[model samples]
Target: MKTAALKTVDRRDGKLAMAHFYVAFIALALGGLAGLLQTLVRSGKFELPAGIGYYQILTVHGVVLGLVLTTFFIMGFQLAAVSKTSGTLTNRQRLIGWIGFWLMTAGTLMAAAMILLNKASVLYTFYAPLQAHALFYIGLTLVIVGSWLDGAAIIMAYARWRKANPGKPSPLLTFMSLVNTILWIVATIGVASTVLIQLLPWSLGLVDRVDVLVSRTLFWYFGHPLVYFWLLPAYMAWYVVIPKVIGGKIFSDSLARMSFILFLLFSIPVGFHHQLTEPGIDPAWKFLQVILTFLVIIPSLMTAFSLFATFESYGRSKGATGLFGWVKVLPWEDARFTVPFIGMLSFIPAGAGGIINASHQLNQVVHNTIWITGHFHLTLATAVILTFFGITYWLVPHLTGRTLTKALNKLAIIQAVFWAVGMTFMSGAMHAAGLLGAPRRSSYSEYGGAAQAAEWIPYQVAQAIGGSILFLGIILMLYIFINLAFFAPKGEEEFPVGETSEKAEKTPMVFENWKLWLGITVLLILFAYTIPFIDMIENAPIGSKGYKLW
Candidate 1:
């Protein structure tokens, strides 16, 4: 590809991307407020008001931040990346994207209203037996369908590009974006199937009861991979965006493609790892999923190695002298580099904790404890959310044709630091308290006056402090983003597109074969899930009538 062509810019694409982002940030702000309230309540420093319950707040926090925010943001970012790297989307594609966006936004509003009204406080997972309003289920279904349409738009654009340039490797950003979208579409099947086939009817009174185990089984099938749906966009930054921000190229384009393919294949089938403690499924299947879970880790390790290699190569060329010297030579002053870099460092502990969670023996220790809570805060909150902040440092301005002021740039650095420090304190306390027998998803201040529970109080207080700081950080991020979008001076800034160190002029073509990888991904999902799903159905217990416990 010519350098000039690679620098393509399209305002139409930016508008569509920003539309998704606008909704995403709204979700972030509201959900983050709920997070603050959660910590306060847990710390025994605050109590819920008459109309607002703890679980209601928890449901909004999880759904808005975890599901709604991540989905919209990823779609926006992926669309933006594809347009810049590949080519502009046609008018029809833009129309489809807008339609999808409206559907998603409507769905979000419906779901939010239901949760706030205390009609759908079933929590984000919405596990069966905890019944919610039918509108809640229908709204969620619309969100899923909207996202599918959005993904389809991106895929269509890519397909057009491939048709125009037969045999050429798809641009790295486009390829990564496409793979992530496909992974999402495929991973969502588990949840969509359950929601459409079971939950909607059950909630609507078409079915008097629903099988608890079967519903849970279906949920876990989508639940674990849901984590990756959030992580991959962040990984795209670590792989593609960070390299460019630091003035280096990707170490190898082929390696990055391989990692994405591996994720597509391994991420879905490993959902059973989350159900290691559940009894309906046999231990044998759990073990198989555990092995598959470990397999998914390989791609992440590959990414770490590739990124280090890029840093080293750039560092040596700039006169750095030692194996570790590259660390100092990278662009530490750039918010675009440093913010996401902190996020990358966070994943080390988070990923290690995930291994423990997947372990059949070790999971018995921390399965329902706050330790799992700590683990995810590091992963999704720090590793994923921090990266999203970094992307916004440039992405918002890039879309709005605005200049990111030097003053605001420094503030961005402080924002990232606040998040890191706050998460460390909160997640640290969570881990310590959980190991001491603190349960998760509870509003327990007094453990029946047990002395052991007293130990957790101090940690809970620390969590409140950390939560406050993190809340402040998110508020700062929102202010900066809004300012960049509407108030900054107009300026020209190129979208950063990292070049392949050895460009794909003559790379192996096998890496670009989407059909081959997609086939294998489906096969692996079947291999891992078929027997267990069949068994669950054949010996399924009678469905239980739903309960409104809250």
Candidate 2:
């Protein structure tokens, strides 16, 4: 239980957190609408009105949902977690965080306007040789820099806490928040270098061409770890918050901390796994990175085990009989628990798909196909998105002093069900169609009704139907949040923080050694990336001029 002194809340920090979440939801709404349009257009039954193109819709969908929404939400959620768990943020910290938030929001708007005007149809990846407006790159670069400032605010807060309470292990939630913030700051270095030094200059006409291979190499350097950037927050909820909602304690705090540390060590160097299919990277290096990719899975497996153990222990305490009977005893009625629980379940298949993607031989079969798309939806769309939904049910009310209405509570459950059903139809079909050699990232009518192409139409229709249902689910979520934010009855809810069932014998000092882990992570990244990067730069081909393909 938190002591009275420890439970103090900061109004300024809370306001900052709320501001971040509000912007994130706006992106979510806009992105979901664009996604529905993309699904319809790809289904071949819907056509864009004059002046709008399919690729523009797609670029907006990916950029808003994938980049903007996730970045803002994670920053807000982590700031809140850190402040609540460690202590209230100081006035300076709050001011710094707010500045970051505004810079990020401004950057988002600038890039979004460019996208809307069809000035930058480059997809979220914004791979080189397919340039966007310089403003688009500049705006995104600002978002990254802004996020770094927010991370600095968080780290500074943690540093002060450590100074005041020397030798005390950080609270697990605060520790995990710090881990993710640090991971993000470190991982973005590659992409920041790419944008600031390469893409921005090329886009602004300071340079006529860019080395495609080198640019791509820099992107995936940041890109694959970007997956973990979206995931670790969800894992934070799974490991630290869900157990308390289910009337249980965390299974093991030490294991959880170790997992976070391992993620720091392993996540960044493994990005080359995403480039296994590309040329210019040596096969030996790609194979080595694939092994590192497999290493990253260890932390996730640890997370899965820890979560299940928490669930199983909770079940047995409730008098569940037999070994597996505990599974049936979980708190399925609570949206806070069930939504994240379902997210955990979804990760099983998502993790499997990731392993398949990492396998060099299997990757050749599925690379750039709709299977990858299905896999994407399974991991981020279901696992990350659903957990965020669960966080919303508990978090909004916690921050706003508003009660989640009984009607909205029931609606939350329905929302999860709708999302699952929609993703099932949509991603399942995409996976099947992918195996049959259906293309991805294209409008299907481009195939001109070939025999093989005709086979994918029904699955495309399934995806459209599924996407429509998912959009409805998001709409319902927005309604619940809006009601809670502005109109629900005013009442404070306790922040849920679970303790470990067994007290540790001693504080695990090794787990708290951030510098040690960070240094090792950097070394691993250098080992994995140094040679390939040099090879690409040294053997540069005639660089390609930027294209406006869309």
Candidate 3:
């Protein structure tokens, strides 16, 4: 068996991965600024200057952070993890990665240009009848395609590893990366289909009308899975990397693989949960999808249990006593562990909020409300983004042939604390306002001094304060990133991957049986969506002509 070694990522592969990070961080800087401005605008304390529309900034905020930043960072981190664990990518694979990176970058620029020109202020969701410039659709299509190519590179690398090590399970990190790549590729097909078949044609005037329900349905199909796409990477770090960081063994490789498999199966078919309140979809199908949505919570809870077990095992080994004593034994000062630890802590509330969102009765109350917005912020913004930040504490330095210095490490922990504080204020206020019936995706207004609208203003102002603090957090993160990438001390920083515990059974080979899992995934999706989808098309109304309300 190939034992774990202190191996640096190949310099060539590092360059490819770093290219993705560069774009990711750039998106963060721009998107974070846009986010700050959005909070200020919605707080009714500031207005866009020089005719820049509120929706324009909103579009930038959502697209850059929600789509661009997440996609780029995830891709970059996965590539590096695969390379470190599986072996360096071949020259051709690296070439494919570069091509995908540039394509995504070009697409991002094209789409951004249109948005900045005020011709594509449709927001990140870009749901029609809110049409954007044709270039915007085309640009986004390129991004999706580019992501496919990037995924292809990861798949190829995995294939090569499996071929070389015929009887062995793939490295846990590599396997996890492969799973996420597959999930992304499968999930993106929904968004890609909607864009190519529906939105692009309508935006280009090739089609006079677009099906709003179908477009939205397709979007939510991709949309719900997209959150998992952001999340599974964090889970990878949580399951495989965190144990190694904190001087503990993986609780069970089998359990980890099982949870990831469950996520892949349950994550994709539950889009109707998002559309529960929308018309034209049958409640039965919605209920079924909601059940699938709830099933995904199983894997999440499993992960939590595994982590607790690992922590307790480590603490007990260290002679710590008492039921919760393990928590005290954890390496609290290690940024690599502590930063993502905060993210893990945040997910408790985040997951609860998700359960509330997915519930049918509760959905009616919070539907289209800022509560949904708060839930989203907590899930991706705190849980996922903070974990990504944690990864960067070591990843950027490791890739750059440097070490995370003590000062920088301390800064990273501080940055995470700032993020936690800021998100609490922001997301907390959003939930409060949303429960009070504040609408989402709208600029500030008093509704002619209506008392209900008046009630939301205080929360909005709290959001502004939180956003400002979050912006400072962003600035700190960027500073840490720049130092890690360009100026950190020249040395080796380990790319940690944990070993499985001896007490755990070997990971089942069945976990690697893609055909079986994928087959079930497809069947579940068809069972949930195929009938409703066909009902949509067969009973379709005359589609609405495109509108640019912004």
Candidate 4:
């Protein structure tokens, strides 16, 4: 192939990855505005001027930050991982990727516009009985469809790479990309069907009294998996980027594959956990999802073990010994370690809230409180957002063929670490406040003169301090993109990450064979989700659902 054609493919993939970065950061900025406003409202500091509508801002913040930003970033990361593992991309395939990017981008913009104009006020969940404009449903469907197309492109590229290079176990990067794409294909179909067959028609008034249960079940069938979809890229970095940066091979490529496959199978029938707070869902169905929900810890724990083991090997190779000594030996200065560290730490509270929210009894105390927001913010901020920045800094020197400024890069890592630290203290406070019955969305600090409610004020104030640290950290991270565009050396320099490209090309299965783990993964997932689906739909009465998807 001509150098021009190769450069074309390279440039397209690189730009799309960065496109996701830009879009995600912008979304977070909006969410931060809403989040800060929410804090202020609770703190009794400031309120939106008249017509600035809290519900609308909340909805915008939620959808933009939660859905669009996360989705685009994953799509972007998939392209990067696939390109590295597959060796090269075909030109036609490259174009499809960009087209997918544009469609999702347009759909996201249209949906965000609806939120800003106050035409869509149904909140992010937009649970029915409350409806958003028809355009909201249509726009979201477009986003889903666009993502499906991106998944298809990835699937095709993986196949082509496989055909051209036979009998070799697929590279870990390509393998993970396939699993994510397949998961997305199965996952998004539910919401797409719900939107096309039920929600959209009802919104257009073509149907009267649409079965609320049907749409709600389908919407969440996709919804729960979407969270995993948002999360998979970070997990990818954990498996691939972390070990490479530590100068260690992954402990078990097979384990990583097993975890990804488990995610696909378990994530589907697990939607019922999300509905535990709402009324009208079949009680047995809820329990089934909950049971499966807890099972997720199995795969997650495996991931933790695998990453730690990888860290252990690196520590041993570097001549460190014992359980905790390895911790100090690992290079925290590396962006990969820094991002993964922040990501893993953030999951501590997120996992706790996830467990409480999943449990039938505990959820009642803090459902929909500021604690829930704190949990997800910790999850997103620590996991995907920081990792996205980390991965970008890791890749940019190679992509632009420019030597990145070491000082600014280190600053980015500092800011990211600080963001994670801030969320830790802040999210902990949110938990305490929630237990005290602090409300989630409110502009007035008065809390209707409920004294206990009023006592939670300090935690809310504490979150602003956390938020300020987080916001400044974001500024340092964002400065890199600006710095890159305006300044930076023209040629790539030798760097410590000299090993990543080699490893991406060939990641050895350090301990276990991926094929064996792959089989175990399939069995576990099948066991986890199989009965849940039957109990959810087959056992429940027709039209038995209580809530509707907006």
Q: Pick the candidate with the highest TM-score.
A: 3
Cα lDDT of candidate 2 equals 0.87
Off by over 4 Å in 1: 1-3, 6-8, 446-448, 503-506, 543-550
> Stretches of candidate 4 above 4 Å error?
1-9, 441-446, 493-550
Instruction: Estimate every model's Cα lDDT from 0 to 1.
Output: 0.87, 0.87, 0.91, 0.70
RMSD, one per candidate, in order:
2.6, 2.6, 2.4, 4.6
| Cα lDDT, model 1, residue 279 | 85
Candidate 2, residues 366-387: lDDT per residue as tens digits?
A: 9889899899999999999999
Deviation from native of the Cα of residue 176 in model 3, angstroms: 0.9
Ranking by TM-score: 3, 2, 1, 4
Task: Name the candidate that leads on lDDT.
Answer: 3
Residue pairs of candidate 3 with colliding backbone atoms: none
Better of 2 and 4 by lDDT: 2
C-alpha lDDT of residue 476 in model 2: 91
Better of 3 and 4 by TM-score: 3
| Model 1, position 383: C-alpha lDDT score | 95
Q: Across residues 1-550, which tens digit of lDDT does each residue of candidate 3 receive?
A: 1435527888988999999999999999999999999999888878789999989999999999999999999999999988888888888999899899989999999999999999999998998899899999889988988988889999998888888887788888888988889888889899999999998887878778877888999999999999999999999999999999999999999999999999999999999998988899999999999999999999999999999899999999988999998888899999999999999999999999999999989899999999989999999999999999999998889899999989998999999989999999999999999999999988675365577778889999999999999999999999999999998889999888898999999877888788998999899888988999889887777545434211
TM-score of each: 0.97, 0.97, 0.98, 0.87
lDDT-superior candidate, 3 or 4:
3
